[model samples]
Target: MADNDVSQLSASQQQALEQFTAVTAQETKDAIPLLRRSQWNVELAIAKLFDGEAADPVVEAAERAAAPAAARPQIPPPSPLPTPGPSLGAGSRNRVTISPAPRIVPQPTAVSRRPSLLISLLLFPFSLVWRLSNSFASLFYTLFPFLARFRTATSPPSRTQTTRRSQNPRDTAARFIRLFEEEYGTDTGLEFFEGGYAQALDLAKNELRFLLVVLQSDEHDDTASFNRETLINPEVVEFIKTQNIILWAGSVQDSEAYQVSAGLGCTKFPFAALISRAPSSTSNSQGMSVVSRIVGPTPPQTLVLKLTTAITTHSEALERIRATRAVHEAGRAILEQQNSAYELSLARDREITRARREAAERRAREEEFARAKAEEKVLLAKNRIAWRQWRATTIPKEEPVGKDTARVSIRLRNGKRVTRRFNGGASMEEVYAFVECLEYLDESATDEETPERPGGYAHEYGFKLVSPMPRQVYELRSEKDGSERTVKDCLWPTASLVVEVDDGEDNEEGEDN
Candidate 1:
């Protein structure tokens, strides 16, 4: 068969064929035929090459005796053969005469079979008894279902049952303590927090206390000694309590405690770590830093000394931080107060400025009113003077002729007297004009030139032509004719007139006119 025909053979058979060809230095074709004849037994194929008809005992003995011993290479013994029966007598064995014929030994089948059958027969009654017992018990359970509860009550609780019963943190901690005490003995005198690692950290942060985390592993050889000597030491306990440190203990068996150990990169059992916030940390984001670590078994004094040293060093820095914070707070408060004062002062100044502006506006209004009143008085006087002058010019003037004239004497308010003569036909307006001329002339005689007159009769003085006898005032107009009357008609021929200082009523009337 071709080399590819070897692919059909099993892996072991193909390996044996290749070995046979390589050892014998024969072609694959030559080795394949021999391998096929030998049923793929490499050892038997080699043996066949040395002695033909190697399967026949007589022929193999004769060849071994005849062939020179040096010419034949020794072959190692073949592996144990399969058990012989009629199955080995098939035709396939006839084609492949590979090794010596296996010896056929008769087996004592009855002798071996009889003992097993007897043993089974002896154990049959016991199996029947067990089945009957099981049936009875099952029937009892079916009849009285409540009896099942008694069986469960008698049985011990499983791990899952106990776990469910103690799911609370405090219960779990109690159980942990109980188990630890049972294993290591009671009265350990070590205080342990009932909460988890996170709760311990939060307590430490809130109280500003150091966190002492003790991770215990039961598998460690020194765990008991460390707990008894270092952890339970009275001095260590007292110091931790006095320093306000929170102590949290956990076992390696707990899932959360195991996780904490892994995170802290703990390699040794009975590991103690001191954790606290960093000195410069202002928020939780900065997190806690491990201040000191004690591993394995440490003496109580040494552990205490290390913890105290860490506290002293970090405490100084913490004090400094608090002092700086206080200073900053004080400065900020002062700045706020200053800003408030400045704002108050600014408000007061604005109020004062507004008041001053209002006062100035009030004064300006009062001054303006006074000036308007004075100007109104001056304008009224000019109007009255112009009316008097027009009246004087319009009245008819009569020159005194012969004895038909009237002589009028007037007494001025200054106690001066003035006498004027008018014809009997002259109007009374002429007499009033003569008195006004006397005022102007007298002012001009004393002063270099009188200031421009406003043209009304001086309101300070008023004149009326009154008769000394009967004390009758001259009428400005005739009652009968409703025309301008002559002075002779009012005073007749001669009369005395008086110029008197007017009272407030006359001055108001003059202004109205």
Candidate 2:
């Protein structure tokens, strides 16, 4: 088929095209229209190949008159019966038949012949009698089990009957294989599929191969010849191998095989069927369609032809199905990759959002802390100014001039000299206060402009006084307590005090003030 024409077809349809071409050996141009006519059914398309053609009325009449006998199917008379061979064993019911001459065997009719209702009614009495006799015999055997063995030995040779239930399908399969090898010899060159019926069907369906099912009846007249001549033929073996056909065979005596025969509706022994995946219109519930069936004995040539027809007809359709599966798998893989990428991107975005939120919270806390610290600094500066104003007013304005008074000389940090007098009872704190107000004394000359004392303020002076000659230092703020001793205790009557800047921890607030 042309590329564009094939592309327009669905996967199943494309598969049908390949199958039709392979089986019919038709050119692409011819196969496309033929497949379309069958609605893309491979089996239907192959069936059409053998269908009789429609003729014009005049042409049909002329042709019929010219070759009336030729138009009708030629079914030759039955061939002479083959001679009976030796029995398989003394007690064995199976009898082998020698190979007979090759002859054309007609395909089975689609409709089965059914007896009339009158005939069935007439036969009902005989069937009832037979059932009654069998039931009595079974009851007798059950009662006298030891006598049953003697009865079996005297009975006519017959195939063993079995129940319908599966009794170890694998074992049954293995047993069949072994029996087939023993009967036909291992050199037959044909190998049977090594599994149960269901397993064989699945293998054929999945691999797009043909499954050939052979059911043998040991008691049948033609089974021996069929196995010996037709199955062991070199041409048949080669065709099966080259075409990759899965062969599965079982004897009717086996429960598993009996079930398969009943299911396939086999009417004759030595039966064979070719099965494969086909269009839904022609397939069974399991999607398997029977391609060809050979009942009774068939020649090796006919078997090969039948198998070839089935293989070619279905090959292309399976190829298309495989292609479709591959495409679907690739699409699933791509979808998974896209989903993985999207999940990763989502995770990254979530991480970024969390980090930004945390950073914003940290910045808010830092800004709040700085604002509180600035407010605290303003309050401390106000308290220090109030304490300084209060201390300036409390200093003695005029020098004490009594007998108990003491005179002291002080040098300020500004390199200026100042004289001051204090009472004998005056504490050292009073002396320091006098020096602190010197700035006010020089600026105003009086205490009239002094500020009021402030509450709730603990103040520390930034400068300290020291006697330079002895190197004794006096701090404005006491380490132990706020109390101080009188200056007379250290500089009684006369003393020189030097004021230098204090560089202790108390200087922090003083510098800010």
Q: Write the per-residue lDDT of candidate 2 for residues 84-179, one digit (tens) a residue.
A: 333226112211111111111112224558889999899999989999999998899789887754543333223345432344667778887888
Worst 10 residues of 2 by lDDT: 94-103
**Predicted structure 2: lDDT:** 0.67
TM-score of each predicted structure versus truth: 0.31, 0.40
Tell me the whole-model lDDT of each prediction, alpha carbons only: 0.63, 0.67
Candidate 1, 1-513: lDDT as tens digits: 333376777888889877776655767656665675576877667666543434556645765797676764454323322333223344233223211111112122222344487788999999899999989988998899788555533332222222223244455567677776786667666667877677777777655678888877654556778887888788997898798788877765655565566666666666888877554334436356666677767999999987876665455445434444554566688899999999999999999999999999999999989889889877866665654444434434445555878777778655678676787777777776666544344334455533443453444325565666677776567677779988667756778887544455344332211
- Window of ten residues with lowest summed lDDT in model 1: 97-106
Backbone clashes in candidate 2 total: 1
Give per-residue lDDT, candidate 1, residue 489.
73
Candidate 1 — number of clashing residue pairs?
2
